[model samples]
Target chain A: MKHITDFTIVRREQLGQHYFALTLRHPGTLPSIAAGQFVEVEVMGTREVMLRRPISIHDVNPAENTLTLLIQVVGKGTRQLATLQEGDTLNLIYPLGHGFSVEGRNPLLVGGGAGIAPLLYLAKCYKAKGVETTILLGGRTKELIPVREAFEPYGKLLISTEDGSLGEKGMVTQHSLFSAAYDHICTCGPTPMMKAVGRYAVEKGVDCEVSLENMMACGIGACLCCVTDTDEGHKCVCKEGPVFDALKLKKWMGIE
Target chain B: MAKLETKIHNITLKNPVMTASGTFGYGEEFADFIDLTRLGGIIVKGTTGERRQGNAYPRMAETPSGMLNAVGLQNVGVENFCKQVYPRIKVIDTNILVNVSGSSIEEYCSVAEQINELPNIPGIELNISCPNVKKGGMGFGTNPEMAAQVVSEVRKVYGKTLIVKLTPNVTSIVDIAKAVEQAGADSVSLINTMLGMAIDVERQRPYLSTITGGLSGPCVKPVAVRMVWQVAHAVQIPVVGLGGISCANDALEFLMAGAKAIEVGTANFVDPTVTVKIVEGLQDYCQRHKIDDINDIIGII
Candidate 1:
């Protein structure tokens, strides 16, 4: 189910100068949201910005009717979003796109930078189901990775920073945990990192689903702006998926 | 309550607020967010003779108060639309219009002819103004002769209301509007996204897959209103105005400029329920002004 409604900003926690966590409370009960689903948040109070920014579900507390968006100030939209304070009203079209399917006994969740937002909710969902989960997050530097401690309770958290300022250094794909065993791989981050992880999953004969951060307009299937080429044809990332199986993704498999 | 009912040729709109082609999908996508029947009309995605893969990735780029899209009219094609899409969307009670697009006159005729067979579809919006496609789309729309030729050809087969969508890229939008009107178009909608481009300063590259894409949003509203006003004064046929229409005030501007009906475009992406809100807003505007009919405001400017 999807919802297009206003959510009041109950909490605004600045993770860093560029990163912030917006915890929004819906006036009504929050819709049933799955892991990897995202929200298209209207970027208000900005003159130049018109399109609603698509932000992944960082966390959702249905009991409290709250949803959290971990946004990084990458452009005008997110920059305007960062300025939103507590009690501000933020309109959102939420729980959009197909989320990651909880399959396989063991899952390895990999995230990088703001891409890590969705993975936290995914890990939380997988953990609640009693599925074993491992999270590997990577960033250029330690500061790039925000809210690392949140995933601690859900799974075994692994960190990789290029500057060696955090856990064992290098790209996330270069992390030593690659040698360990995981039945399925769910990774989101920069395209290159997801591609590397997709390639590794294919080679190891493991099922993999990677979330794509494509440029979108409608955040629905209508616009067809955020389409990703796959063996099946052009799929709208906003509708069919922001998450896709590695095998079906032609670019991820290096087939295209 | 104000009379929002509007007529475009034989087809009647419940109100003047219709969803723009390419933005509203099949009307089912927005069923969760808004009531489908509340809209005056639902214009589905552009239907071509065959399936289009559309442009490559990065087909969209956000500009100041607007966005650029080079979607290239990606759709399931007319055959699949009749087979797979029509059956699904036909149940909606409001007026349903198919946005017919093609690279050639024959393709346009073929798609329009097929859509004409659907009993529930009230009309077809011949998309001669799609700027993204490499071939026929805007090519026909840019020239007076080609635009009239395509509309005349499609008009032969399409039995119902025919709305010719016009691009704003031309020097004289009225000339193209009059051409289509002379060629037997029952209505004309303008301006179908002004051609524009944006560049990412950081990457030192163009933002969209196609260097230039159709620019839409509130930034293009004034131009659209001007074009609608121009075409309304020039053409006898009804003028359907669109482009950067986000709210009721923008819709009112078009109505005042001479559009009998209006379509909500890029704003649908921002707020899914904007079309209904505009419909309600128009009612509020009418009630506030003590106007009995929305038609009274048409061409007031």
Candidate 2:
């Protein structure tokens, strides 16, 4: 069940130049969070910031009831979140939105830039299910690539940077897996990158899902703020899914 | 116990606190965050006569103290609302008022008649003040004739309480308030999100997808209080005031401004439990002042 509970910041770290991860330890057993699911984090610096920030769950420590959030400091809310340290109890609505499905034998997870956060947990889930896992993580430069070591143990790791600053010097779609055989595939990145991956999957007839990052308020279906057009019509990204089948989206099919 | 009871015509809400329409989606969504029955009332989302696809994406944009939305009444229409939403909300033990909106007076009456069939729903707030839609939304509320026409027409078939929610964009809101009252409206609620817009200078475009949207939050509180006070004085019906009310203290201002009750709107986005908190705050304020009746504070200023 989803809950609004107090989570103390167990630790905090800067994954790279652009991303910071805040690990929150819940007071009780942590709810089981699937990949692609997110949490609404209440930033506590000031009363002026009226809404809670919706962030994807970066990683989870179930036994200790702690969860990590990957926040990119692009605005005031994230900058306030980056200011917090260990021991401060922050409130959170845990395990929100729909998560990824791990039903395939061979699964390839692709992530671009900061969108790699949720994919790590997704890689771990697929690994636990005994599926062969491979992750192709991308960034603009080597310095922007987030925590690489955390993902190394979960799957076969691949990297791409635009400046040849890291591994292969190009987008994640440039990886051989872009055309490689896989039973299922998942991608989360900039919309154009996701759309590109969607086009490839459609051509290859591979099952693919993409997590959308629409601006949200209420972090629930009630507000109707974060809606996306799909084959079934408009759906609240906060509820029906932040993770959606690539084929169901109108944009993925090159229609919208 | 303090008398927080509020009666408009024959219907009496347990308290003068209602989750405003649009902000509170069908009352069922906030169920997990707070208890539904504890609220004074729940004004579900705007429902029209037919299922509405609403406006295009990029509907809501946030501001410093408030937010702007161009959702344009995206709902399943009244028929689907009755079938899909009504059963779930009907179980909640509180006043559930459907905010009725439409492109025409016939549309308003058609939706109201549907709500009239639902047994648990106590009333319908004729939403003539929605500024987000392009058609008969705030257009009706801005004009006294259109406002009265919808109210008078809905009042004919709908036997329950008919509350007219007026827009703040009008030249003289008191005229619209008086018109609705004369049309047999049981009560009136004020200040449904002031018409406003924001711009993205870097992108050189409008902030909201609709070019403009309804501005709501703490910034609009003073305007809401002023309008509620003026309309309460101009009309004899009970007044329900709302605009950027984030806390109990904010709600007190509206009550003192002669509003019989108050609705918490955009504040719910900030704090889902704010209504219950305001309910508690009102009681605490009454106790501190040694005032046994909550209604005594109305128009105290």
Candidate 3:
């Protein structure tokens, strides 16, 4: 079911120069939200960006009736959304799209750039289940990196920056962690980076799932935009996934 | 409640508010969000004789007060709609019309014939205006002779209400509407998305993978109203107006411009409950105006 609710921005924390975290508080009972799922936040302040921005669920605190979103300045919509101040009412379609799967498999979470928002929640869920987890965070530079304070307690956090500014210097795939073994790998980032990660997993004979960030209007399956061609067929990234098994996807270095 | 009944060809709808094609994917997807029974009708996605994978990703982009889409008729074949989709939507307890598309006359007639056999499906809206497909979509819609040919051929086998959806990407939309009406279309729906393209200035690339996609939203509403008004005057058949309709006021604009009914298109993405909301709003409008019937407001301007 779709929940259209009004929320007030209670806290806004600028993580770095480009990234910020928004904490929105609602009055009613919170809808069931899972890791890897996202919410379609309506850009109410402007009519130019009429369609809602699909932001991944960064975190949710039930007792406080609050939801968190970690957003990076990407375009007009994200920039406009970032301007929302504390106490501003916002409308959102909550808990949309299918989330991640952790059944019968250990997970190594990988996130790069704006795709890193959903990983914090996934790490929390895995930590609660006593599943040993590790996260490989990638970005272009240390200044562009998302804040790691929330994700630190959940798992092992490893960071890589292309400019050699922080953590291990280089793209995520060049990090030393890829040499390790794993039962499953879940990643979300730019298509190229995820494809690299997917290719690595496929080569290592590991189960892999990648969350796609396709342009979308309706967060629901109504709009066929956000469709990603996979082995099964053309599937809506907003519905069947923002998350899919790497093998089910085509075009990841000849998986097609 | 004021009488919200509306008629398209021989079939009477519960109201004048229906969900537009391609926007309202088979009724089940919105079941949790909107009560399907409250809608006047539902026009599901475009169905062809063969399954189409549609276009490449970045199929859509947000423009000024609107969005552009190039989802090139991604649908399961007509047979799949019968075996899989029909069973799910048949029980929705509302009018369900199949939006049919094709690459050739034979494909159009064959797909319409298959839908004609389905007891639950009351009609097939011939989608000759789709702009995303490289061939056959706008190719047929832009020419009056070709539009007539496709309509006449589909009319032969599809023994049900035939509503031909017309394209706005043409020199004269009324000419095509007249041609389809002359070719025996039961009704005509105006103003499919206008062909448009947007560029990502930072990337120096087309925003949509198709490069050119159909533009829909509040930005196109005035053009839709103008074409709908023109087509309504030119053709004797009922006109189902749609373009950038988002709310009841927008729907009313189409109705006042001479549309017998209105279809909420891109608005479904904004609010899933918009159609039902428009229905209730229509009722409210009628009550406020002291009009007993919704039909009294159509073409009233």
Candidate 4:
């Protein structure tokens, strides 16, 4: 039982029609979070939703001890979470799951939909380490993409939209910059999109890692509910990884 | 403060908070967030003779104040559990109660027989409530005669305490409770997840991959208490209650309704340390009420 000391909604900014970025202050523990970790937020306004929604760590400023989450109002929980104002307290469990492992020198970051949250944190960490980083963000349309300016300071930015509304005006794979120009590729998004990126990286003989979005019960490994088959039989997405080397992912989970 | 302790049948629990089977894995998964030694017991996921991969995607969906899960009893076979998970979990301080599920009476008996040989294990909770499998989980439990047959066969080989977990997805829970009691069950746990389903109206498809699932959470607490009350009155054996117990107040409701002990299920997902809190809460409730012995409140309407 992790106790929540305080919850401060720092600010809320609408990213698109349905998505909003919530900047929160969780003084003591929020400062220590690494890239790719997430927090389970309990929605305060609604009586309809029961389970807490698991949101990715969009950005974190350890100096200020503040955390920001990029949330899409897909359902009742997120809608209620969106209603929270500054100084409003929430029940939050943070720094959950195995975060990313940045071992390589130059890394290629890929993100699609809500998966972009963790990629931004990854980009920041890599750039701070003096590693050359590139980020490719994908969404349904230009307006659906989030946090373009914040990521600019960290690395090269590439955008892809399904409706040809921004950047490459096509799928992320069609972008000219994604022609295996980087040393390693890291991706998070819809299973199909990530699998496509992973398959391309494998064929080009570049190392790749993918963050999975399996629906979880405990966010810990206890439920055996969020397991993905890998070369190692079965591994918990919350424990072994929410991030896995693309090469190790089994065929059924889609990476070749 | 002195720690609270409880006993169900011959098994001595350090506290009255145990993780309901199917919710908490073999106890090692929550080791980082909770102190397993502080808990009364941990019921492992349901296991059978052969490995089951369980249902497809979208096997879970959240409802108002609760959730539905149709995991279809996905488990590594009995051999793998004994070889892989058991060795590691045997080291934990809490009592480990293996939840046995099967497709046949023979399968149930075999699983119980193997577990009976394990040194540290205290008991077996027969999961007769799983609704997702094709054969024998909820199948035996829905029918009183079949439920008795399965319990009787498992009892023959099982020398330790046998707790038959009853399903509430039937007409009369009391009838099923009576059936298991007559079969020589040491105790019975009431109200496993209720049969339920959710729909994605936009897509016009069912929410769960199985089309239906077992519902559990705070929403089901009253119904579970009602069943526990009815079942306790129908049988002389101890009745352990579950289904939607998230706090000590909720657990105490079951105890007052005639349950000797309670299992915390879906609440584990809400808060991993819920069982420890529940035990402390129970002690606090007893202390405030000027009750010296915690068991004094059991079945005290």
Best candidate, DockQ-wise?
A: 1
Least well predicted 10-residue stretch by lDDT in candidate 4 chain A? A1-10
Question: Candidate 4 at residue A2, lDDT?
Answer: 30
Give the range of the ten consecutive residues with the poorest summed lDDT in model 3 chain A: A247-256
Give stretches of model 4 more than 4 Å off.
A1-6, A29-31, A228-235, A253-256, B1-4
lDDT of each: 0.91, 0.86, 0.89, 0.84
Q: Clashing residue pairs, candidate 3?
A: none
Error of 4 at B79 (Å): 2.4
The reply for model 2, stretches above 4 Å from the true place, is: A46-48, A251-256
Kindly list the per-residue Cα lDDT of model 1 for residues A72-125, writing each as its tens digit: 999888888888899999999988999999887888999999999999889889
Q: Per-residue lDDT tens digits of candidate 3, residues A88-144?
A: 998888788888887434678989998888888888888778886788889999887
Cα displacement (angstroms), candidate 2, residue B110, comes to 1.0
**Chain A superposition TM-score, candidate 4:** 0.93
Q: How does residue B199 of candidate 2 score in lDDT? A: 94
Ranking according to DockQ, highest score first: 1, 3, 2, 4
TM-score of 2: 0.97
- DockQ (model 3, Cα): 0.82
CAPRI quality of model 3: high
lDDT of 4 by residue, B133-208 (tens): 8888999999999999999999899999899999999999999999998998889998899999999999999988
Q: Candidate 1: where are CA atoms >4 Å away?
A: none
Q: Which one wins on TM-score?
A: 1
